[model samples]
Target: MTRTGSPAGVLSIKPFRRLWIALSLSSFGDWLSILALTALAGSLTKGSAENYAIGGVLVAKLLPALIFGPLAGAVADRFDRRITMVVADIMRFALFLSIPLVGRLDWLYIATFLIEVVTLFWIPAKEATVPNLVPKDQLERANQISLTSTYGSAPVAAATFSVLALISKVLFSQPQQQANLALYINAVTFLVSAATIFSLREIPKQRGKVSVPSILKQIVAGWKFVGSTPLVRGLTIGILGAFAAGGAVIGIAKVYVKQLGGGDAAYGVVFGMVFVGMAAGMFLAPRILQEFSRRRLFGLGIIGAGVALALIGIIPNLVIVALLTALCGAGAGIAWVIGYTLIGLEVEDSVRGRTWAFLQSLVRVVLLLVVASVPFIAGVVGNHRLHLPGKNIYRFDGPNAVLLIAAVVAVIVGLVAYRHMDDRRGIPLIRDFVAALRGEHYTLEESTREHGVFIALEGGEGAGKTTQARLLSIWLRDQGFDVVMTREPGSTKMGMRLRALLLDKESSGLSSRAETLLYAADRAQHVAEVIQPALRRGAIVVTDRYIDSSLAYQGSGRELKVGEIAEVNRWATNGLVPDLTIILDVPSDIGLTRFASPADRIESEPREFHERVRRGFRALADAEPHRYLVIDGTQSQPDITRKIHDRVRAILPDPVPPSAEDETSTMPAIRD
Candidate 1:
């Protein structure tokens, strides 16, 4: 959720790094095998039989997932994940090595199917293991890195295959021999992956007895959970729709390219470009749309893909088609990464393996159906050309017509899925998108237990922040809420030292950047030790000050960039924005005069500087009016307290109704 930091932080975890490397190697090997097996299949047959042979190999590779996916997922959930992955990899290595040694078309199909079956088990285990290795908040960034490795390795694999092909041809002078060498190398990659996974001790093993009935029960439960949970159901449908669109594009691409008067080379370039766009979207969309809700972004990506696919059918220019294809790929990339991250964040660890397996199985089935059907559908549609006015020719083909239909379906899927899965409800999608484009920071309401309400009181010197915070804490406690009264820069034990350094007059000469960093250090510790833990325990936390103080005093008053300071604070707090911030508005001169004694370092600043600080608070409130409650600090203490109570009451859940006996027993008077 903290978009300010680089994704490199996820890689800093040694265990995740090891898994990432294994994933990359395995992915590279997978792509390489695709090329090698296809070529080998062609070589094993003659004339038109070669085409059938290649198609058979492809089908054999994909069909196992459809047949064995559920069982694979069950196996992953029932056993030690590290052992599951290692065993899967070892099986893959052995099967891959056997392919060339057997050297028969039938044997090739058997080996390919076996390898894919093992891969199905490895994938779910890997997906489930990732969330355990990284912190919950860092799941998005970790998913980003995993996805990049998953898809980004394709180009490298293609290049490696080409190099291997050249070397084999020059050394052995046999095309079949070259294909065999590539397979041998691909086999080695799986061995390396197995060795790597074996070294990872962090992947927890399933405890207690494992049985067929229990595994089946878990699988059934996983399916039921997916079907019953609206968010998960919506995510599943959206992911399938995205895959359907992609599968259609891939299945019909060869014919579509020819329809546009292009050859194999054009098809290759277009294919490569789509993945290039996908990599760009995965890596850059987070930074570009940093402020947008992840749920909205997922929906938008699906919509974007649908729109691009629709446009590709309408536009006749091949270059334009290429661009549209790239855009579609980019949208798919964003949706894919976000969807995976959401699963990790939302799903429980106990059922995570089975849930991921169900998703994986369904995805493979949908992809296979779309990939198998699209080509046939396009073939049936055929081609129709009409000569129009102004020497323009209009061509309607099977690919074009099928694409238009797929686009419509995809759009409908996106709209429905968006409505169901949007976590930030009531915020219009277009407004959120525009706000994100402008880089405005906002809070995303996660669908977690509504455990606590965080209210931050901000004001200049002598503006009664401490008094208001204390009053709110007491009122909340009286209403039967567990209240934690705290303050920034001095809340935790470590923060006490930081607070002294920040407030002491001797530290007045501290550099602006250093002062800013000191505040950030205190805030980081405060959030970790005080804020997050209390909130997790369902305690209402009322703090005297938070990030806004830095924004006001250091950012605006010191003339430093507010945006940079905001990013620093965002990183420090790991994107934990307060639910509500009450800004007690008071004139700088009057507020300063109310302080009867010597001022602290921040308070001792000039009146103009304090005025700038006041304006800073006002600007923030204006930007996010819903989150901020601006009150006149000059009002009576009772009046200010009543106003805050009203606003907070509207946000909090209604209190439980007391029983008649309890009501009769407790008729205590309200305190001033």
Candidate 2:
């Protein structure tokens, strides 16, 4: 399951290695600076004035994400992304170093705001670099490693901050001044982050002229693309929801903690709980994804957090509240990995930075809004205006009202997430195994055989087969056959990813033919992982096309010879072939006419090349007559389906119908 670049997986790139090291150093520096600032704030001001100032500084830090996330995103897309981070880090470095010299309250706010703005660019710049670093299959692991940095840093930093604050308190009368020196150390980290970015070397950028209109258009275009892609949209929204609630909970945590029992010491214990909980949550994420029923982890995280926070607010006991805080913390950590992993998987390289920035900005905005509402809510509860159903209305002195609110929202959101979304693993290990090995994932009902035969459609583009497969799958399901349906470059995780790259019109002329091996690699996983298993369990599996598509597209379309594709694919699956392949035959013109926009990467290939791919698929079908049934796709939908059903019935004899089943010409109030 771990896909780090090595003998087994593909994400370990040289540039990624350097970037990871740089990121670790940057994270360490970030921790050091934060501790320094917290200590300084603790000692600098005499009373409540200092807390307000500290809070103000914290608000300022969050502003960049709210105010300039889009602007930063635009810059990353239009210019060198690596340079963007370098510049952001450099900017922060200079500001932090200057902090000690200024030593005034005003300087603190200025430094905080500037550091935040720098973060706006830094986050997107680093996130955008991920896809280029490794193969899609390893993205989850890459994200895990990236996330582990924050999780790993938090616990260590908490301890470090406590120790450093103690030392500062002992050494200087003006302890804030002693902590002030730590800002210089933070500055050094920023410098190192910038230098490390500078060392990343050149990476390819999107090819085209960059203009104001183009940049704006590109940003809008990215959003449009997101809206249009259901997979992308569903996952993004789920992530956004979880992040928003997590933000509000974090905002209200202080009040919730103080009420529990500990005073100032409670801060470390609670934060430590969060760090530990989230790290543990993050660690569980991959396993849950691998083994559980499908659902988005991000949304799950949100719901988990929401429920946890609400419990903290309602639970009065400090120990339980601490545990709840940990739950909330863990949710936040898991959500980050899932959301970032989604972004890395879905977007293209050219606009990757902008897309990342857009998402960063989006989450930041959500966080900012949640944070801003905290004190206001506290005031309301304090004034006796706020109340929730079946629970006490928390007073505004602290975070209880807000924490309760977050918890309720989390449960609602978690339910929504579970009900709507499906799990998207990096690899659909179990389903793929079932499909490939011909086994039933769930218990097969005895009566299912009397209804429909499950069949999956698979094939290459321009093979004129998707419609045929769809028609066949429907006809089979409708003929009192219990049909479950799917297609390939697949409905599964590994398959969907390959499909995005393979059929993407915008990706034309970019992917290497040798890279067809990746497509084949995905298929091998699909087959050994998906197809045969379904067949073994009495599923009369009918596919539009299966391994045949890779053999055609990667083999002939990319010129990797059909046999080599077969061999590697064979190695991938031990030579598993589909029980039946219904290849929809088409003259190149008829097939070409089917694509109205011709906007996809693969579909836009030169005419002769497509013609050859068309020929290649036909030949593959012809070569495997026992498995492949060539059909005329130019026929009407009903006619095509009829032909497919005919082939299915010819191969798999129907099971005995129930006594009244055949006699029931009645509508039976059943909608198929």
- What's the lDDT for residue 80 in model 1? 90
What is model 2's C-alpha RMSD? Answer: 15.0
For all candidates in order, the CA lDDT equals: 0.77, 0.61
Question: Model 1 over residues 14-99: C-alpha lDDT tens digits?
Answer: 99999999999999999778777866776676543444465567678778765675677678778898999999999999999998
The model with the greatest TM-score is: 2
lDDT winner: 1
lDDT of candidate 1 at residue 465, scale 0 to 100: 97
The residue pairs in collision within model 1 are none
Q: Each candidate's TM vs. the true structure? A: 0.54, 0.55
Candidate 2 per-residue lDDT over residues 553-647, each given as its tens digit: 66556655444565566567554545456666666666777766644766666666665566566545432233555666666777766766676
